[model samples]
Target chain A: MPKPLLALGCEGSANKLGLGVVSHDPTTNKTTILSNVRHTFNSPPGTGFLPKDTAKHHRTFFTRIAHEALSTAGISPSDLSCICYTRGPGMGAPLSSVAIAARTLSLLWDKPLVGVNHCVGHIEMGRVITGADNPVVLYVSGGNTQVIAYAEQRYRIFGETLDIAVGNCIDRFARTLGIPNDPFPGYNVEQLAKKGGSVLLDLPYAVKGMDCSFSGILAAADLLAAQMREQDRILSAEGGKLKEGEVRITPEDLCFTLQETVYAMLVEITERAMAHVGSKQVLVVGGVGCNERLQEMMGSMAKDRGGSVYSTDERFCIDNGIMIALAGLLAYETGFRTPLEDSTCTQRFRTDEVHIKWRDD
Target chain B: MTASTGSQDFPCVLTLDVPFPTARLASIALQSLQVDKELSALVRRTFSISSSIEGARGDSDKILKVEYKATTNRMLRVAFNSFMESLNLVVEVMEELDADVLSTPIAA
Candidate 1:
């Protein structure tokens, strides 16, 4: 039997720095998650994470996380077959921060380096974890929003956001509400949205064929939040009672409406992609994929079409190092190694730029 | 940046020499650090490898030299500060994951 291969993956695409080790058997097509560790940088409540600060967070914690991941997996540098790092499609500084560490490790252990695309990493990890075969992928994250399907060795984008991403929209709204960024703004928004739905506030729904827009929705939502705050202030001054002609509004209602409108837009485009590609399985990946409401909405939509939606928990759905490791290992198996000179990062690497050589279909 | 002579525009300048234990390590550091181009047009930077030894063999090329020239002292400070962050990370990784990290003492 051919020996099993092990890979170490480093991911520092944005605010999160993740390191993981994975094992793959050549003969059985089996993959084992050895150890996956992550460290996230959360800025203040009203501020988004800056590039330099996020990069510093990754730099400060990378060595410690790497040691923990390797020891947790009970392995050393010599046991690894290759070093894999996220190459592009993320913030440049954090990506470069991770890439430097990956390069250093490669040279130290005399191991080959594999540069994995971030979107492809999410999709490949989703497939492995959910065992979904040829599913239409909905990749929703702070930096990206796309509906992708496999064709001709590429994860072709059928639909995408024209402006800000859905996650960005929600995160900004969370900031407008002064929600803390302890875990993530999206998660906090979802929790708030669950308490809402007593009143469905009106918000713009922008879905154009295979593409959608979120900036308009975000603007409308922000305006509604402002109105809600104004109403709250008026009610407080008026002994907790609004004027006879005025209607009460709450922040929770705005959150609920935002979730419903944006998720409906995503489902509409995803349904179109499924029809266009003639695929039944739907795989939701990326950080926003962890939202229970989004999953429930997607689940119902898929069920109506005699299909099912596949998603993983936070550990696999969020930006992680294991996905990069898995995707890079697949590429490494296919004889793909990024040369040291060519290992550069970009902030705008699109999903279609990579050719998927691992999957035959 | 504070060292600016105020002689002309872009007067503030700084040069940094980062030494590694081995020539190969120094080259690795240079290759890894030089990939990311400086983001600011106000800052001009260059990277080169040098050593004190003349025509040094295996381990003679042991210094990574980085020079910075910016329009102002503030620009120089910001640019070199970021560079130092990256440089610190590289050295840290070398200490943690380098092959020699686990060298065991030999007993007679």
Candidate 2:
């Protein structure tokens, strides 16, 4: 049998512009990622964040990166059967930039352009890397967190956060703790939680059916932290503060509590989704997926189910182009292409809106 | 082809002329129809007016001319109800209303 076609995927959602090239070999029934390129945007301090500015930045950076990715894979654009890009459910400005770039490339190279859902791309990539064919997908990122399962020409959401995502909760909590907003601050907080000797402060846990409310938890965490700090300041002024080192909840301990509480909520919801779907496997994907504690909890859940918990290494698991490309190729083969007139931008595209096709073999 | 029905269901474009204060009036009318049993599920599609309005000047008789694509009578009725509801809800700026302000629906 002939080998499957090779496709390139482009992603520029949030701050990262990622590119990946992959081949689907039908003879072996496997997909191989050739190479990937990633670039990030750092808004200058005090410069207001604008979606359109990011889009403008993408137009300048994309062509060179595409070439770099192709060359890194030791392949040419001419060898690509199709080019895929994230279509919607992202900042309209950035989505349009990548869309326009993809269309231009497709037109020039005479290749088909497949628009892939960013969320589905993340989930499918997680599935591909972990080799989890039908695991429950808990997708969490800067913008989204939805418990999803693939069925009926769509990846249906079993449950999701009704408000802000779990990661944003952790990130915003870190900021309230005066901790820097970094990719791994949340992870740092996780480690601190490990070291923290439990105070077990009372905090709200909001879970509704399979769906959850992270915003309440986040608000509570922030308020608690703020209130504790205020009390500490008052004690200091009264000369009644801890004798040099005596403290109830240190910064590290606060970080620990935040991570523990957020992760517990996520774990609870994930387990609910798993039990509801009756699926043995669980696939965790997103920036928060990198958290070791989250992984451990999911691993135990998988063990209980007599199944395996699958996750990718930091690179593939994090938002990137490789997942987009891998998922994009499947969509392309399924004849999922958009017309020029119908092309538009969107910010809240749900995962179940698109039909996904990719086999884990 | 054999003649089968008393009246044929012809697909035609009907231009609905809505007399309202502003486009916001039309938008409000549409929003109200979403939960109204008579018109809730009848709205097949909706589009915003793009051209700037300068022709109509009467406060009591502002016109919102909508071109609707409908086939069956039921759908046309829904469109009419939706348009009327939208017309009723339109205001100078959305903040003036007591309704919960929502983030605009993400266009796809």
Per-model TM-score of chain B: 0.79, 0.35
Candidate 1 scores an iRMS of 1.5
Q: What is the DockQ score of candidate 1, to 2 decimals?
A: 0.63
Q: List interface RMSDs for the candidates, in order.
A: 1.5, 19.6
What are the per-model C-alpha RMSD values against the true structure?
3.0, 14.1
Runs in model 1 lying further than 4 Å from the true structure: A238-240, B1-12, B53-59, B102-108
lDDT of 2 by residue, A75-132 (tens): 7666788878887677866776676556545644557777778898898788777888
- lDDT by residue (B4-106, candidate 1, tens digit) is 3433656887876777888888988998888777889998888999984344656588988888889987998899988888889999998876766744332
| lDDT, candidate 1, at A111 | 94
TM-score of each: 0.94, 0.71
Chain A superposition TM-score, candidate 2:
0.89
Query: Looking at candidate 1, what is the lDDT of residue B62?
Result: 91
* Interface DockQ of each model: 0.63, 0.02
> lDDT per model, in order?
0.89, 0.68
- Native contacts retained by candidate 2: 0.00
Whole-model lDDT, candidate 1?
Answer: 0.89
